[model samples]
Target: MTWLVTGGAGYIGAHVVRALLDEGLEPVVIDDLSSGHRGFVPEGVPFVTASILDGGAVEAAIRDHSVTGVIHLAGFKYAGVSVQRPLHTYQQNVTGMATLLAAMADTGVEQIVFSSSAAVFGAVDVDLVTEDVAKNPTSPYGESKLIGEWLLRDQAVATGLRHTSLRYFNVVGSGSSEVYDTSPHNLFPLVFDALLEGRAPRINGTDYPTPDGTCVRDYIHVADLAAAHVAAARRLEAGQPLEPAYNLGSGDGVSVRQIMDAVARVTGIGFEPELSERRPGDPPRIVASGELAARDLDWAMRHSLDDMVRSAWDARRASTP
Candidate 1:
């Protein structure tokens, strides 16, 4: 089966594309290169350089490639920046999703796997977040993701579309040395950048109500995450029933201090992290249980904390110079 991966040139999307190819499925990519690297896309894979907002390009890609399904991952994904640029966020994420869905409907392509985010469940009071948690997004980025999921649900009802959204938290590590997380706002890249520059990495809000006095988050390996996407696609192609959404979490929380420790241990860079005041709206903890995803999508924490840090660091270092 042929699947079109939106933003396939991006870090996570590239990994997903590789996973699809490994599963013996043809993959086509459409990315605007806004935050994606052209080199990240493997050669010989059909690539269309266009935004999902462009209906003509999107429709043509679907028709020309004979795309059987889609893995939607293109959007403005910075939650903090979305607060300052809400309109831009909505335009890129919400409007882009609508356009993609309309293109799918026009082409009679029914199946889609949306790349949703844990940001949908903002500041959860529960220890382990499930699929049914209250979605109180604190930023336009998170709000846009939730609306994207809604678009899939509404399209399913109206056009008999088969779709599922995979909500994940803090994707880290690299499945291959060629692809690495490049987000400026993500913690992994931030810490790595600081270390490379011979500066101390800053840990924000170390006074949170957690065991380590730092915010705790669930981190999942990108390779494991990519595998789940392939599993979801296979199930959908087989006409198997799937939940509306599934959380790809590790079921274990890692504190910022712990991550710093791992980086020091893996990279052999021994330096104290500069602790700073808590950023506004910083939550104490946000971890989820992947029991549902494990049962259905064969999701599991295949990589440990050090393994995640080491792989990401190695990939990042290899990409430098």
Candidate 2:
């Protein structure tokens, strides 16, 4: 039984496809190429250029591929800008998720692993965020993710669907040099772009309550995160019990200053980040405990902050003209 990986040509999705292949599972891909590159789809994989919003197209891909499961990842993921494009965000993430689920139901593909985000929590006033935290999403992007989770839950109750949502903070690092994070809004790419352009990377806030006065957050490597997804899929395939959601996090998160320091050390480019005023509603820290994921899904901080920086730098350099 094969797995259908929606958005499989994107950075995290591409890495997820590799992880599934490494586990001896066949993965078929469907991507709209809006934010994903067609070149990122591996040569041997079956590729369908379509959006999850197109439910008929999604269902056709699943039926054509004889898919038994799915890993849903395609969405408009910019939390900050989502406020300005709330309808678009809902259309892509909320309506798109419903379309995907409807297609899965039609195809009888009940097993799924969703690429959820810590965005669902927004800026929570807590030391360590958990699965049971009162969700108070502040942006359209966050709200869409939370609503997607709710849809999954409702589907599970109504149709006995086997599903799990993986909530992650900041996903970085590449499993292969061929695949890299290309999100224009992400930190690694922004910093890499600045460095490659011969400019210093900038930090948003430097007077928070955390050590070094920089915001702290969990930053998991993409490969490790992908492995957890595969593990969840395996559990579902084996008819074993799985949690509704798991946070793949570094319990004690590294600060932005620490990331800047690591990047400089790893890339051998010595320069301090320029500090600016904190963005509105930016939290001082938003770390989470991955103990549950560690126990069930083989989740761990396998890469250090420096390792993450080095790998990301290598990929960015490799992709440069």
Candidate 3:
């Protein structure tokens, strides 16, 4: 079956596209290239350079490719920045999602897999977040993701749209040296950039109540995340039941210091990370249980912490030249 991968030129989207191909499924890409790279989409995959908000363009891609389903990943995804640009965030995420759904509905497309976020459950106190956790989004980005899920839920009820939203925790690592995380706001890229420039990576909030006096978060590999999307799509195609949402996360949490240690070990860098005060609204710990996803979507943390750091570092280094 052919799938439409929105934001397919981006790091995670690109990985999803490749994963689709690996499973003998066709994938058509539609990306605005706002924060995505054209080179990331593999050759021979049909590419549409348009925003998801452009209903005409989105409809055309859906119809032209005979897309059986959509993996919606296009959006303004910066949570902290979304706080300052709430309107832009809503425009891209909320409105863009509505537009995409409208186009899909108009075209009789019946299935979709949304790329949701753990941001929907901001600053939780839980040891392991499940899908039923209270959603109190802290920023427009998170709010928008929650709204997108609502859109899907409402549409599913109204039109029998088969769908599921995957709530990602902390996505890291590379499936291939060809595709790597490029977000300036993400942790892996920031740390790698600091080390490459011979500067110490800064660790915000070493006074947190966690074991290492730092924040703890669930980290999952990009490849594993991609596989989950495929599983969801296949399940939908097979007319199997699925939860409205699933947290793509590590059951156990990893501290900031542990990530730093992994980076140093992988890169052979010995510099200590600079400790600083916690950023406002930053949660000390937020890990999630992927039990539901594991049961339904074959979700698993296939890469170790060091593997994540090494693969990401290697991919970033490969792009340096």
Model 1 compared with the native: what TM-score? 0.99
List, residue by residue over 112-189, the lDDT tens digit for candidate 3.
999999999988888899999999998899999999999999999999999999998889999989999999999999
RMSD of each: 0.7, 0.8, 0.7
Model 3 TM-score, 2 decimals: 0.99
Which of the two, 1 or 2, has more lDDT? 1
**Residue 197 local lDDT, model 2:** 88
Error of 2 at 251 (Å): 0.3
Q: Model 2 Cα displacement at 51 (Å)?
A: 0.6
lDDT of 2 by residue, 138-234 (tens): 9999999999999999999999998999999899998888899999998999999899888999999889999799999899899899899899989
In order of appearance, the predictions have TM-scores of 0.99, 0.98, 0.99
- Model 1 agreement with the true structure over 171-271: per-residue lDDT tens digits: 99999999999999999999999999999999998778899999999999999999999999999999999999999988877999999999999999999
Error of 2 at 111 (Å): 0.8
